[model samples]
Structure formats: C-alpha cells, structure tokens
Target: MSSVDIPRTYGALLIGALFASILSGAVAVQSLIYQKMYPRDPRSIKLLVFLIWSLDTFHTGLIWGSLWKHFITDYGFSAEIDHIPWTLALSIVFTAVLTFSVHCFFANRIYMLSKRSWILTIPIVLLAVLRLISAAGTTVEMMILQSFSNFRHEVRWLFTLGLALSSGVDILITVSLFYLLQSSRTEGGRFNGVIDSLILYTFETGSITSAATVVSMICWIVAPTNLIFMGLHFVISKLYANSLLVTLNTRKNLRNRNRSVSGSGSPNNNQALILEARRAQGQNSATDSAFHVKSTEV
Candidate 1:
C-alpha cells in the first residue's frame, strides 16, 4: 500500500460504513411505513417486502461486523485494505440477492407494462440473472482468493461485468417503464398529470440506482485497492428497495391523481390508470365477472 493513499483508503471505508448504516436505517423506516400503508397487499407483494427488509438489515449488520473484525480485532494487520473479510464476502451475497430481487420486481412490472412483450422483458431478465450469478461468483472468488489485490488481479473482469449489467438492467427497466407510461399519455388531456408524475418518479429512482452502480464501478476500476467504491456499493441495494417501496407506498397518491383525471372524460387513460392503481394497491375489487378487459394493454 502506498503511504500516500492510507488516508484516502481509510476515509473511503469509514464514510462508506457510515453511509450504509444511515441508508439502512432510512430503508428500515420506509419498509415499516410501507407495511402500515398496504396492509391488504397480496401474498407475493408482502413476501417481497419482507425479503427486501430482511436483507437490507442483515447486510447493514454485516458491514459493521466486518469493520469491527478488521479495524478492532485485527488492527495493525495492514495499512491498506488488501484482504477481504469473511463478513464482507457474505455481505456481497446479500447485496446480490437484494439487488436481483429488486430487479426481478421491476422486470415483472416492465413485462406487464409492455403488454406482456416477451422480447422486451426476457433480455432484461436474463441480464439481471446474469448479474446475480456473476455477483455470487465474485463473492466466491473473494472468499477463495481472500485478498483484494488477488481478486482484482485475477477476476476484476467479473466484478466489472456485474456492475455493468446491474446498471444496464436498471436503465432498461427505467426506459421501458417510462416508454410504456408515455405511450399511454393523451396529448391534450388532464390525464397527463398522472402519467407525468409517474414518469418523473420513475426517472428519479432509475437514475439514482443506475448512477450509483456506475460510480461504484468507476471507483473500483480507478482505485481497486481503495475502499471508496465499496461505500457507493454498500448503499445501492437500499436505494433500490427504497425506490420500489416508495412507489408502491404512494399508490394512494396515484389513485388521487387518477380520480381527478377521470373528471376530464379521458376514458381510456382513466381506465388504464385505475387498473394499475388497483394493482399497485393489491386490490382486486373489480371482480371475476367484470367485462372490462384488464388494462395492461399499455
């Protein structure tokens, strides 16, 4: 380790640890609020919420455990981070699972919104699956190699590839979702408000997740020996979960917007959004005998 880089490395890891804890707390609180808001959600949606919160909380603990084991238990071992701690390796698995869970959820939404277009969603799903597998592979390699330098020297390509694919999946999901919503927008109708709000919300979430992935990869590639990249990566899955939950949790807001759109006689847009609004809320009150075709035709 270069003497000149000691402070930089320490600063990165310390800041990353701090940020991860804060974001984890934020997501934990958000998850609780989501639970309160959507007490009637379907089993599948509830299970997803459980999984996201479980993994986020566990990984946050893993970060602190690794830090304590390294900085306190094994202090003076090295001036710079070259070795990968076992807890950190474990956290990688959680990160991959958390990230893939979020990806699959969005892909499912994309699949539905794209009117069940297999072509549109299958590639995105495949990329997401590949990323998870690659991320798991990275964890295994880190465990076996046990040294950050060795991991980077031998399998950095895998690390970089996983990050790239993660970003790709996020971007694809965002664009597909926005495109579907945009296609549903009528040029002169008040319904545009709902669609526009959804668009902006989707844009904000997608951009944040994708940008975090890119910055993490850039830092790792630029300074593989430094912990700066880990700081960005640590909080990334929380961001994904938060964005998804926030969108889900705000279905009431979407409903309120849709109700106003309905007064304008935009039958098509109102119908489509109502169906979506109901689905988001996990409400199936439309019944098994309704003649209205499910509005996923968007």
Candidate 2:
C-alpha cells in the first residue's frame, strides 16, 4: 500500500471502529433499562446485550489488527515491526467469538419465543465445535501467514459458511417471533404493536447485514479490495445500532403500557366515575366561593 492508500485504510477503519463503539454503548444502556423494567428473565436480555457488545468489540479488534498487519509490518512504509506474526490467531479468535455470539443470540430468541430449551442447545454446541476446529491446528510460537490469495479464499469460504448458518437461524427466529406476536395480542393492541415493530426492525437489519456480508464475500473472492471489507464493517455497525434502537424502543413501550394499565380501571366504570366526581366537586366549589364573596360584601 502507498502513502495515499495508507491514510484511506486507517481512516476507514477508525470511522468503523467509532461507529461500532457508539452502538455498543447504546446497547449497554438499553440492556440495563430492560433489566430494571421488564419482568421477563433478566438473563436472556443480558445475554443478548452481551452478544451484541461482543460483536462490536470483535469488529473493532479486527480493524486494529488489520492496521497493525498492514502498517506496522515490514512491507509497509512504516515497517516498525519487522517480524510480528500478525497471528491469524486474533482473526481466528474474533471469528469464533462472533460465530458463538450469533448462535447464542438466536438460541436465546428461540428459547424466549417458543420456550423450547432443547431447540437451540444442539445447534449451539455444533457451532461451538465448528469454531474450535476452525481455530485449531496452529503451532504454539508462530504460524506462517499464508499468501494473500490463499488467506482471502479460505477466510471468505469460512465466513460465508458461518454467515449462512447465522442468517438461517435468524430467519427461523424472525418467523417464530412474527407468529408469536400474531397469536399473542393484548388489549389496546399496544404491546402487540411494540413487539411486532421490534421484531420487524430486527429482521430487516439482520437480513440486510447478512446480505451485505454475502456481497462482501463475493467482492473479496473476485476483486479483493480492502474497501469492500471496510464496507462490511460499516454495515455491521449500522445493524448493531438499529438492533439496539429496537430493543430500547420495545422496553420503553412495554413500560409505558404497564403504567397506563396500572393507572386506569375498567374503561367504562373509570370514565363515568371520574366524570361524576369532577361535576360534583365543580358545583360545591362554585357555591362556596359565591357564598363567601356575598358575605364579605354585606
């Protein structure tokens, strides 16, 4: 990479890291709020928030790792680190973490909606095994970095497989949530609307992020530009931000609904009683004020 390419590369990575960090912070705040307000199992919501934070953390780590590999390595203009391994180790770990995180998130969603404990556990175990296999087979001290061509091809294939599985699980969860919301409407349509909207936003963001990853893989295999990889990071950040927003909004709407329901009695009786009480109070106050004023004048 030339001097010009260097600035562009670092700049893009920095922007992506910042975006993902902001999103992670938002998810953290929303998670805390949800834990306090919602009566649902706190563990599930906490796990979801943690997974999201992990995704963003891994993403930012990847960007920094790439910067170190490219700029600090001997081939680059700076060349500060002549022989750092730039271990595929961190990359491998990042992929594994992200893969497991996705699996956990989907499993939690499935468990939440269907209450099927066994449904998600098996696949999660399988995914964990796959990730471990993908990470193993390296020597303790230093592993030789493959040629860019080979590395790109291998990473693309592995990412595609992992992404496909994650997206498939997400789609299943999305469909389940849709049906769950449809079947479980509450009075006033308030809770149901919030649930449906949250689900819809999650589905849309997840689908688009997965699609972008597919496109990025294609671009990697065909053209092999750093820009496409950077774009993938940005898209992932956007997905994280949108998912955090949805979760926050869902919690807010649920809290508001609960407050409204708790404050109001049965609709008809509450309204009639409120009206009659107001009318009687108004008449008595007027009569007293007039009597007092006349007595003072006399």
Candidate 3:
C-alpha cells in the first residue's frame, strides 16, 4: 500500500516458510515411523497418513513458490507487494483441505469414543465442513481480486469466519475428548494411571492444535496488514499432521503398559482390563478381545 515494508512482507514470509519446511520434515519422519511401527493399521488409516503427508509436502512447496515469486521473480517492483501470487492463493485451499481432513478424523474418533453418538459429533463435523467452505471461498476471492488490500477490504470476513470456525472446532473437539476421557476413569481407580496418561495425551494434542489456530486468528485480526498471520497459518497444517501421528504412534506403548498391569488375571478381571484398555485407546467395542488393541482410525 503506502510502502513495501520488506521486513514485515518478505521477511515474515521467509521466516514462516522456513519453520513450515522444518515442521514438514518432522511430518515426514513421523509418517515413516508410523508406517513401520503399525503395519497392521487399517488400509483407510494408512491412506490417510499418506494423504496428509502428501498435502503437507505440497503445501510446503507452494509456500516456497510464493516466496520466490515475491522476492525473486518480482524483485524491486514495490508495487508487486500488493499482488497475491497464485501459489499463495492455492495454498489456502490445501491448508483448508488438510485441516478438514484432520478435523473429521478426530470427529470420527469422538464418535467412536462417545459410543456412536451423532448428536455430539454432528455439530463438529458441520462446523469443520463450513470452515473448509469458507477457506475455499476465501481462495476464490483472493484469486479474483489478486490484491492483498482489495481482498482485505472486500471479503476479509470470509477469511475471518474460516479462522473462527477452525478455532471453534478445535476447542470443541478438545473439550469433548477431555470430558469423555475424564469420565471413563475406572470406578476404583485401579487403572487410573493408564487413564490419566490417556487424558494427558488427549489434552496435550488438542491444546497444541487449538492454540495454534487461536494464535493465528488473533494475528489475522490484530495485524492483518502484515504477513504475520499468513506465516502462522503455514504451520497450522503441520501441527495437525504431527498431532495425529503422535496419537497413533503412542498407542502401542500405552496398550503394552495396560497389558503388563493386568497380566494373567482372572477371566472377569481380564475382561474388565480389556474394556479399560479399549476405552483408554479412545474406543468402545464390546467384542474386542483382551490382546486386541483397538485402532484409533475413524
């Protein structure tokens, strides 16, 4: 607008892209570990990991392209600072897609943990879907306007709505999971240790993603003139990817601990332990055997 603030415009972009790439590397490492550690996971789950990783990788590439366009291709052209590159515009769609996938994945987990309760899960899914739609609309408007100032002035509400929905969904998911896990603690606190571990894990994962979304939303609202918000937005998808992988990868250890705690018990005790174990894994299935570890995939 008034002047090309290289620090806030390009420098913020460079820093954000660097962090996003580093996190993408973490995603790749975690994805490979998940594949190696849990080969028995369902086909759909495997496919989901692959899809999220692919999207993350592609999103990283798009970010670099946008950076290149701004700093290299259009260097010294101060007026070009206002124009939104196609790569950046499209990255919004990918971010939305990644967020939507992760949200739905968790929603399905909540459904399973809540004993197939649609009443609790439906609102979350609908909010996530609306978030995705809002992102798509933002992307379309960005492309059509092709100018940061124009987009901000005309359709800023669309982007704002999308961010708000993302935060709402994240907070809702975290609270639902925390409440469910807290309520599932055994009557006598025999397996309180295991349930406590699960509750801690759920709270940590949800908090990480929700905090990132909330911070990004605040940046978007308070400093929309700069690229700081977009920088944080770049990392949100990576957080979601890593959170899911961490959740899946830790299941084996937790299941083993549950087994060790309840080893060689009487038939009734063994059955109770199995139910507790499944519940700790965020699942509820009456038919699950003692040794069978329930998959976290929706």
Q: State TM-scores per candidate.
A: 0.90, 0.59, 0.89
Q: Across residues 1-298, which tens digit of lDDT does each residue of candidate 1 receive?
A: 4532666776777788898888888888888997897677666788888889999999998888878876887787664367688888888878889999888887877766666789878988899999999989999999999988788789999989999999999999889888888777655645667778878988999999999999999998987777888878888888887887787777777776676656655445444433345443335452111111133322
Top-TM-score candidate index: 1
Off by over 4 Å in 2: 1-18, 21-62, 72-89, 117-144, 153-156, 186-191, 225-227, 230-252, 258-298
Error of 3 at 90 (Å): 0.8
Candidate 3 regions with alpha-carbon error over 4 angstroms: 264-298
The digit string of per-residue lDDT tens for model 2 on 1-298 reads 2222445445654665566557656655665665565434334444655566666566556655665575555444442322223443344345445545554554555454444556544565565556445444221122454443334434546544544554454455556555544555444532344455555765776566557556655654554534445435444543534454354335444445444643554534322111000111333431100000010110
lDDT of 3 by residue, 1-298 (tens): 7744667777778888999999999999999998887666666777889999999999999999998898999998878888999999999989999999999888987887777889879999999999999999999999999998999899988999998999899889888887777766656644557777777877888888888888888887888778888888888899988987777777778778777766744445422424232322224433111112222211
User: How much is the lDDT of residue 115 in candidate 2?
Assistant: 44
Which candidate order results from sorting by TM-score in descending order?
1, 3, 2
- What is the model-wide C-alpha lDDT for candidate 3? 0.80
Error of 1 at 19 (Å): 1.2
State residue 218's C-alpha deviation in candidate 3, in Å.
1.3
lDDT of 3 at 139: 94
What are the lDDT scores of the predictions, listed in order?
A: 0.78, 0.46, 0.80
